[model samples]
Target: MVLKRIFTAIGVAAAAFALSLSAASPAAAVPVDAPTPVKSRIEAAAAPDTAAEPRTCRARFAENVNHRLRAEAGSAILGSIPAGTWVQASCTRVAGGEYSACGLSSDFWMEVYWKGNWGHGAWGCVQDWEYTS
Candidate 1:
C-alpha cells in the first residue's frame, strides 16, 4: 500500500511540473492584449498601396479575347469580347497570365470593366496585348 501511494505521488508531481512548464511558454509570457509590432509591420507591407489604382481608358481588342474572373488565364471565363470591340476599361496591368501576341510577350493581365458593373459577366481580366490603342 505504501509503494502504491509513492508511485501515485510521483505521477502527480510530474504532471504538475509539466503544467508549470506549459504555463511558462513564450506565448504565455506576453499579455493577452499586448501590441504586436512585428505582426503589424508585416500586415502593413502586404497591403496594396494606392499606386495599384486602375486607369480608365478605351481599349480595342485586335481579336476575340476571353475575360476571366481573375487575372490568371486559367481562371473561369466571364465573357468574350469580339474582335475590334472598343471597351472602356478601368485597367490595372499586373503580373498574371502569360501571353505572347501582337509581336510581344508578357505576363500582364489587363483589367476589363464591361458595361458599368465591375463584377459578373463582361467584367474581368484579359491579356495585356489584347488591348490596342
Candidate 2:
C-alpha cells in the first residue's frame, strides 16, 4: 500500500511538471536563435538603401557656342564642349555660376565628362528644356 502511495505521489508530481511546461507562455520559451530587439528591426527597415547606385545622368551644350567646363562648380575653366555635344554627367546638381542662357534661372551645375576627364558644367533650363522625358 505504501509503495502504491509513493508511486501515485511520483506520478502526480510528474504530471504537475508536464502541466507546468505545457501551460508556459511562448514568451517564456527559449529562443532557437538569438532575438533581435524591436528597435533594431525598426531601424533596419527605416534605414536608407546604401547599396543603390546613383542615377546615370547626361548633358549637352545648349547653343552653337562652346561652354567652359570647370575644375569645380563655378571655378577655373578646365576644358570646353561645343554646342549639341552630349556628355555623361552626375545627376546630382549644385548651385554654381548664374546662367541666363536659354532662359535658365537655376544657377545649377553638375559634374560632367569632357576630353576624357570629369569637370563641372551648367545643367540649367537649357538642358532641362531640350531633353524630354
Highest-scoring model, TM-score: 2
State the lDDT of candidate 2 residue by residue for 1-133, as single tens digits: 9999999999999999999878968777766887433311111222125536545656665653234555233466665667777777665555466555444444555677778777666555234321212
Off by over 4 Å in 2: 1-51, 64-74, 125-133
Each candidate structure's TM-score, on Cα atoms with residue i matched to residue i, is 0.43, 0.44
C-alpha RMSD values across all candidates: 11.8, 14.9
Model 1 stretches astray by more than 4 angstroms: 1-55, 100-104, 115-133
* Cα lDDT over the full model 1: 0.52
Number of clashing residue pairs, candidate 2: 0
